[model samples]
Target: MIRKTMTVLALAASLGAAVGFGALPAFAQTAKATVDAGKAAGTVGEQADGFLAVVSGGDAAQRAAVVEINTGRAAVYKDTAAKTGVTAEAAGQATAKQLYARLAPGQYWKPLDGGWAKK
Candidate 1:
């Protein structure tokens, strides 16, 4: 019984590693895919708030994807703010600048003036 239990535990551990326990959540992965699609279609753009914005209307799935990605970004901003002695909004804005600069040439971005522009 002891040997059988050890073997099972080892198998479970291996399976977990194979499946990547530390990998990003399924929602996050889905969000990335949707964001890519939205960007290509010009329906979504990166906002100055470190979240995605719908420059134009999108489908339900795209909206859900943006929600997931924005939630993750919000959490990150809050955590960084706590560590850096700044407000969450400040951290988010800082991250937005970095991410905006990394946008592809034809990608859309929402500047502080509240309109979308292609990069």
Candidate 2:
């Protein structure tokens, strides 16, 4: 079951990475860097709800970066949902599952189990 789920998530991330989520293109360089650092430091984590969240309190700048990334994700989710005949929340949830698998080791993720763990 775990292997199957991982395979599915990997495929989803690959496809979404190409044309859907647009996390790479949508996030600004500075915001992306901030998010990267946050993830590495365990200060922020990728949420199962398709948004970034602070695992540990961070400065206003870090919070702002999360907002910026989430805004881009929101637009992408809306567009994808419209094209796929799904709700934005559904699309976002699917994308979140995909993105969660993309997190590197030591980065934090909120899994479908509803708990945070290092990837």
Candidate 3:
């Protein structure tokens, strides 16, 4: 019984390793997919820093909303990456500012208009 158990354990370990090794290529493919998505999106990393910049001016509520938007973008990136075999993260990092610029303008505060005003 002891010997049988040992053999079974060894087999399981080997199988796990094999499965893990097999996953590496898939992971690499996922990265490529993300890049493709970024290109297709035409706005990968744009959200993070842009969201941060806008959040700085708004109230706490605004900050939370911006964070939610950024998180949503990341989730999309992950899904796209998983499907296409490109690295969306890398693409986002590479041209975040450019991407942000391309993005539609977000909330803007106008003091004279009378909402919030400036501190």
Candidate 4:
């Protein structure tokens, strides 16, 4: 069961990276970094707490999670991309594309959702 899940995940990530509207593992890498940064800084946790603390806040909570995950994870990829001379915008675009591809309908990374300007 575990192996199957892992395979599926790997496949999905590959698919996402491959047909990511021209983006690839590169973009996903940065997105992951951003998520890590948020987690390490506890921002992701804070956002989750703040969101859950309020009423009718499920959306908020989910949104916060996305933010935390996206920001932290993206940072990781961003740093690597930077050292390698990859443009932030390219990273951002890759992040956005991958996030969109990975997320289900009505769910997505906040920074990547309709916030193309920032990306």
Clashing pairs in 1: none
Is candidate 3 or 4 superior in lDDT? 4
List, residue by residue over 48-102, the lDDT tens digit for candidate 2. 7788888888889899998887887788777765655566666667778777777
TM-score ranking, best first: 1, 2, 3, 4
Off by over 4 Å in 3: 1-55, 91-119
Q: Tell me which residue pairs clash in candidate 2.
A: none
- Candidate 2 residues lying further than 4 Å off, grouped into runs, are 1-15, 18-27
Q: State in Å the error of residue 33, model 1.
A: 0.5
Residue range 29-95, candidate 3, lDDT tens digits: 4443443244233322223222222413344444444455455445544444354444545323322
What tens digits encode model 4's per-residue C-alpha lDDT throughout 15-119?
A: 334322234366454544444344343333221111101112244444554554445445544553454455444434444444444434333233422221111
Candidate 1: tens digits of C-alpha lDDT, residues 1-119: 45533443334333222222236777567778888889889998998877787889999999988887777777766666565566667666666666676678888998777678899
lDDT to native, each model: 0.69, 0.73, 0.36, 0.38
Q: Could you tell me which 10 consecutive residues in candidate 4 have the lowest summed lDDT? A: 46-55
RMSD of 3: 18.4
Q: What ordering of candidates by lDDT runs from best to worst?
A: 2, 1, 4, 3
Per-residue error for 53 in candidate 1, Å, reads 1.0
Per-candidate clashes, comma-separated: 0, 0, 12, 23
